[model samples]
Target: MLKIKLSIFFCFLLSFCFAQRELALKYETRLHTYLTFKGSLSPFIKITETDARVYKSNQDKLNDNPEFIIAYDEIKTFEQLVKNAPNDSIEAILKRKGKTKWSKKTKSEIQILYENEDRDASENKPLSGKRILIDPGHIAGNFEMSVIEQKYLRFVKDSVPNLPVDSIHISEGILTFATAQILKKQLEEQGALVWLTRDDNKTSFGITYQKWLSTRKQIVLDSLLECGAMEKTKYNKLKKEDEKTFFWSFFRDHELANRVKVINKHKPDLTIIIHYNVDEKNTDWLRPTDKNFCMAFVPGGMNVDALKGINGKANVLRLLLTDDFPLSEKISDLTVKEFSKQLENQVAKKTDADYLKDNCISSSKQGVFCRNLALCRLVKSPLVYGECLYQDNKNEYLELSKADKTYYGINTNTRVKAVSDAYFNAIMQFYKK
Candidate 1:
C-alpha cells in the first residue's frame, strides 16, 4: 500500500513540473535584449550553446531577477534551482535599456496601451493634431467649372460703334475657380486638409448664374429652418435643433453665410476665404477706407460670428472667426500689410513672361497698373479674406491672367503657399495651449 501511494505522489509532482515555465533574457548587445518565455519561470534556467556564458557580476547587473537567473551561468535547466514565480510579474520589474528601467507595473501598463489607427477614419474626422483646410476660390473655364468666361458673362456684337474684336470682362465664377486652384495646391503642400465646397470655383456649376443663385437662395431658406433661424432666447441646445449651414448672396450677409458651411465641415484650426475684389466703380460709395489691399476678416476666439443672430449658434470650435465689425477691422489691418508686401514682390521681382502665367496683370499707359492681392477674408478659423489682386486694375489684372509662377505667387494650381505659411505659423501661435 505504502509503495503504491509513493508512486502516485511522484506522478502528481511530475505533472506540476510539466506545467511550469521558464523565461530567459539573452543580451547580444548593450542595446538588444532578447526575451523568451518557457512554459513557466521555475527558477535558475540552464544555459545552452545557444546562450553565451557571462560573469556572475553580470547577474547583479541584470537586477538580481527574482524569477530566473543564470545561477552560475554554467548550468543547463531551471531544475537546478528551486524557485517559482510568474514570468510576467518579473517582466514588470525588469530594466528596459541602459538608461531606462521598467516600472513595477510595466507588464500591466504595456498591455493596456494600444496603437489604433481606425479611430478617426471611421468617423470621417481628422486625428487630433495639426490640420489645415483650404478653399481655392475658382475653377477652370468659360462658364464651366473648369471653363470660365461663359456663365456670368454675355457678349453681344459691338452694338455700339467700332469696338475692335469682342473682348471679355471679368467673371466672378472664373475668379473664384482660379483662386480655389491656387489655394488648394498651396495649402495641400503644407499638409492641410483643404477641401472646396464646389468641385470647381465657378461656372454656376454647369448652370446659369441665375440658376446657381436660385440654388443658393434655396440654401438660405433651408438655413432659416435650421437652428440659426432667428430666436429670442440664447442658443437652444443643439440636440433639440437641426443646425445647418446657410448661403451667401452678392449680399455681405450671404457671403458670410457661405463661410459657415466650411467652418462646420472642416472644424479647422483656421479658415481663409479667397477672393479678388472689384473696385466696383461703386468704390466711390463703398471704398473700404483702408488702402492696404481691400482685405477684411475677423479674428479668432470663442464665439462664432458665422452663427449670426441665432438663438442656437452652430457649434463653433474652441477657436472661431467672423466678419463682425471688430474682426473685420483687425483682419483688414493685417491683410493690407501682408498683401501689399506680396504684390510688391510679385510685380517687381517675378514679372517675367513665364513668371506671369497665373498672374496676367500689367501696367497701363494710364499708370493704372493692376496690383495683385485684393480682398480676402479668412473665416471660421483665424480668418483672412484677401482680394489677392485687383482684376480691374490694368497691371494687376494682367499679371493674374497668366500661369506664371510669380503672378500666382507660386504655381498656377495652388499659389497660396506664401500666405499659407504665414497663416500656419500664426495658428501655431494662436492654439499653443
Candidate 2:
C-alpha cells in the first residue's frame, strides 16, 4: 500500500510540472512582448537561444514567473513560426530543445525588470515619477509672424466677408497650446512630470516669428546652417531658391526634425498631441456645418514610401519591435471613450454626427484609428493625436468662441474645457489605482 501511494504522488508532481512549463512557453511566444524594444523582463526570467531583447511595461511590477522560455531563430511572421513544425507540436519541440539552438544565429535575449516600474510606491501620488509630454499642433502668429514662420493662421472668414459672425481664425497653435496648458496643470496636480513641446504659440524649433521678422530671413537661414540642414557653400544659392522649393524640402523637414529631437531627448513615457478638427467638405469653412465628430490617431498605415527618410528603417523596426502601436491604440481608445462621454454630458445640445472614418468603420464601437502621419510615425513614445470636435460646426463654433462659459463644472470655454476634461478623465482612468 505504501509503495502504491508513492507512485501516485510522483505522477501528480510530474503532471503539475508539465502544466507549468506549457503555460510558460505560451506566455513567451506571445507577440506583444516581442514588439517592445529594450523593454525589461523579470530579473531571473530566461529566454530561448532564438530570442532577442524582451520589453516590459515601465509600470509593471517585478515578476519572475515564466517557467519555459520558448526560443526562435528570429521573430518572423506567424506563418514562418509554424511552417517547420514537425509531427510533434511546436510547443513540444521547444520543450525538447531545452534552450539548445539548432542554428548558429540563435542567441538568448536578456533583460532585467527593475523595481522602479511600480509608480504606486507612495499611497497617495500614483504618477509621482511618471513623465508625460504634450505637443500642441501647428504654429501660427500675426500676419508678419506667419509670413516669417511660413505657416499661415487657419482662418474661416465669414461668408459676408467683413462680418466675423460664424468666423474664426482658429490658430491651431493657439488652441493646442491652450489645451496643453490646461492638461499640464491637471497632470501636475495629479503628481505627474509634464513637459510641453512648445511653451507658447511660437514654434519650439528655430527663432520666434517676431525675431525672424526683425532679422528678415537671415535668422531662419542662420538656424538652418546652425542645425546642419544647410551647407555653408550652398547658403547663398539655396537661400535664393523659390519659397515653395526651400520651404517644403529643407525648411519644413528641419523644423520637424527639431521637434522629434526634443521629444526623444525627453524620453517621456507617453506623448499627447492636441488639435481641433475642421470639416473637409467645406473648403472655405466659411459657414458652420451641421457635422461634428471626435477621433484619435495612433501610429500605423505606413508603406515603403514612409520608410524613405533617414529614420525610415528605424521607424519600421520600432513598429515591428516596440509596443508603441498597441500602447498608442490603448490610450486612444480610452481617450475616445472619455471624450465622447464628456461631449455627450457637457454639450448644451446633442448632434446626430458622431465617429466617422475615411474607409469602412472596422467596428461600430471603435473610435481610435491608425494614421501614418509624420508626427505619429516619428515620435518615439506612445502618442495619442486627438481631434476633439469640428471647429466649423454651427453650435461648436459658438461654443469654441465662448469665453469662461461653465460646463460640467469647468469654468473655461465650453468646447475647450470639454476637450480638456476628456483628456484629463482619460489619463486619470488609464492610470487609476
Candidate 3:
C-alpha cells in the first residue's frame, strides 16, 4: 500500500512538471511568431523548461552561459523589479554581465506607478487623473533647420496647379509640434495631465541643435567612443566633419535616446509620438507625390542582431512578460482607425512602404505595425508612434501649408486640428475599454 501511494505521488509531480514545460514552450512559440521579425529562433536567446536565457552571442549560448536569466515563474517579479529600479541601477546590472552600454541618464528617480483606482470617483472629467506624454517627431524649428534635417517638403511654384502660394514649404517638425500643442490642450480639458517631450524649436535635450553642438557634442562623442559604439578612426573623422554630418549620424540618435529617457522618466500611462508621413518614393522630398496613408507603430520586430545587446534582450523579456505590447497594439489600432476616418486617408498596407516590408512585422490590425524603432522599443509604456498623413503629397502640401490656425503661437492648418481630434477620440475609446 505504501509503495502504491508513493508511486501515485511521483506520477502527479511528473505531470505537473510536464505541464509547466509545455506552457513555457507555448509562450516562447507565441513570442517568436508575433514579436520577432523573421519568426525564427534567435541565436542570442534560449528557452528551457524552467526559464529563458539571453546570451551575448552564439559563443555564450554554446558555452551554456547567459548574460541574463529569468525563471518562468519570476517574470512578473522581474518586470516589477525593473520598473522600480532607476535607469543607472539597471544599466549597472546589465554592464556587469555584458558589453551593452545604455544611454546616460540626466537624472535618476524612482518610478511611481500611478494607479487608476486612486482617482476620485467624483471627478467628472473623462480622463480624470490620467497621465499622458506627447513626443513631437523632430527638432526642425524653421525652414532652414528642416532643410538641414531633410524633413522639409519643398516644391517650386505651380507643381500641382491651383496653388495656395508660389512655393510650398512645409516642415514636418513644425506640423508635429503644432498638432501636439492642440492635442495637449484637448487632453488637458478632459482632466488628463499631459507632457510634451520638448518645446517648439528645441530638441529633447531641451536645447536647439546649435546649442547642443556648442555644449554637449564633444562629451557625447567621447562617451560613444569609450563605449565602443564609435571606433577611434571614426571618432577622429567625426571631430573634423561638418555639423551636417554630426547632426545626421550622431546628434539625431542621441536626441532620440534622450526622448526615450524623458518619456520613461515621466512614467506616463500612455505615450504618443506624433509625426507627419511622407511618400517613401518621393526621393529627397524635393517635389511631391499623390500617395497618402495613415499608420502607427508598436514595439516588436526584433531580429537576432537586436537581441544580442543587453538592453535589447532586457526589453524583449519585458515585452514577453508584461502587457505593454498588447496594450500598445490595441491603442494604436484604435488611433489608426480614427486617423483614417478623420483624415480620409487609407490605412497603410504591408506593400505600401518598403521599410514596412523589410523591417516591420505586420500586426493583426490593418494599419498598426510592430517595428523596432528606438522610441517604440524603449519607452516602457503603452505608446502609439503615429504617422497621420503624407506631407509630401501634392494636395497635402497645399493643405498643410495653409496655416489656418495657431495654437500656442505654433501656426498650423485646420487639418492639424482634425488630427488632434482623432487622437483625442482614440484616447477616450481606449480608456473606455
Candidate 4:
C-alpha cells in the first residue's frame, strides 16, 4: 500500500517536471515523453525510418505551435538536452517573450479550432484564400525526351503477367503533370492560390536524366569532399563508386527531399498528388483490359525507412505535430466519392488482398485509404493522393490515349478533362462544406 502510494506520487512529480521543461526540452526527449500516453499514441506517433527523421509524427491543434524546434547544433540526445535547460516552470515559460502564445488566445476559440466541427461551408469562391500545392507523380516527357518515372514504367510490364513488353506508350509523369496543370487552372479560377511541384514533364529537381548522369558524378564527389568524408587523393577511386551510389542514394532520394522542402516552404493548406492507377491484371498497357479502380491516400503507411536522415526526422516531426491526417482523410474520402460519382458507378471496388498487396484499409468510404507513399507521408499539409482512374482499363486507355484533342496548352483526351473536373468538383465540395 505504501509502495503504490509512492509510485503514484513519483509519477505525478515526473509529469509536473516534464510539463515545466517541455518548451525547452529537446525534440527527441519531448517526443518520447509525449508518446508515453497509450491512448494518445494510438493511430499516430509512429517512429519509422521512412523519410529519415529521428521522430516521425506530431499533433498540433489550431493556435498551437507544432513542436518547439531547437537549433540543429543545440539538438542533442534526450538526456544531454534536458540536463542544461533552465528551471523555468510551465507558467514561467509562458511569460517568456515569443513563448506559449497559445495561452493568449481565448479558451473557447482554441476549442473551436481544436474541434472545428461547426465550421460552415462557403457557397461561392469556397477555395478563396486557400493555398494549395499540386504534385504530379513521375518524371515523364514526350517519347523522344526519355522517361524518368522508371518505377511506374517497370510496373506496367510486371503488373500484367506473360505480356511481351514493347515500347513505352503512356507515361505517368506526363499524364499527372497534364492533370495538375488543369487542376491548377481550375482551382485558381475558383480563387485558390495554387502551385505545381514541377513546371514541365522532365523533373522538379532541376536536371534531366541525360544531364543528371553526365554531370552528377563530379558534383557528388565534391559534396563528399566538402563534408570532410573524402580526401583529395581518393577522388579518382571514389568517383567510380559515387557514380552508382549517387543515382539511387543521393540523386533519386534527394529529388523527393527537394520537393518536400519546397512544399513546406510554401506551407500550403492542402497538397493534391495527381496519379493514374493501373490494372494489375493488365500488364500489356498497349491493349488495356477492363479492370479499373479509383482511390486516394492519406498518411499513416510508414515503414522502416521513414526515419532515415535529418529530413526524415523532420518529416516525422511535422507529421506528428500537425493535426492534418483527419482532414486529409476527409478530403480523400470526398475525392473518392466525387470520382466515383463522375465515373458513373465505374469506380474500382475494394481490391483483393491475394492480388493487390496494398489492400484497402477499412474506412467510411470504399476506395480511400491511408497509405505510406512518399508524397502522402512527407508533405506537411492536408494531403490527398488521388489515383483517379485506371490507365490500363480498355475504356480508360482509349480515353487517355486520345491525345489529338488539345486543352489548356497540353494535348489531352476529353477523359483527362473529366478526371480534372472530378478533382475540381471534389475540392469544391470538400471546402464548400
Q: Which predicted model would earn the best lDDT?
A: 3
Query: What does candidate 3's lDDT look like per residue over 1-433, in tens digits?
Result: 9999999999999998999889687667658866777754367677788777777778998997788777776555556546546655666665663423222231112123322234443567888878899998998869988877888887776554555567888889888988999999989888898999999789988889888888988998899899998899989988887778878877788789889889987778899999999888888776778899999999888766556455667778787767788889889999999999998989999899998888888887999999889888788888999998998886677888878777656677888988998999999999994
TM-score of each: 0.38, 0.63, 0.84, 0.64
Give the runs in model 2 whose Cα sits over 4 Å from its true position.
1-123, 141-167, 210-238, 241-250, 306-311, 345-365, 404-412
Worst 10 residues of 3 by lDDT: 102-111
lDDT tens digits, residues 159-208, model 1?
31232325433454455555555555554554445666554433323433
Give me candidate 4's TM-score against the actual structure: 0.64
Candidate order, TM-score descending = 3, 4, 2, 1
Find the candidate with the highest TM-score and give its number.
Answer: 3
Is candidate 2 or 3 superior in lDDT?
Answer: 3
lDDT of 4 by residue, 157-178 (tens): 4444543443236666777878
- Candidate 3 clashes between residue pairs 3 or more apart in a chain or in different chains: none
lDDT per residue (tens digit) for residues 274-370 in model 2:
9877766756555666776777777654444543432343344455445666678778888887877887622212222222333212211266655
Off by over 4 Å in 4: 1-124, 144-148, 151-168, 214-217, 225-250, 284-286, 304-321, 345-350, 353-360
Candidate 1 off by > 4 Å: 1-129, 136-168, 201-258, 280-294, 299-335, 345-379, 402-433
In model 1, where is the ten-residue run with the lowest total lDDT?
30-39
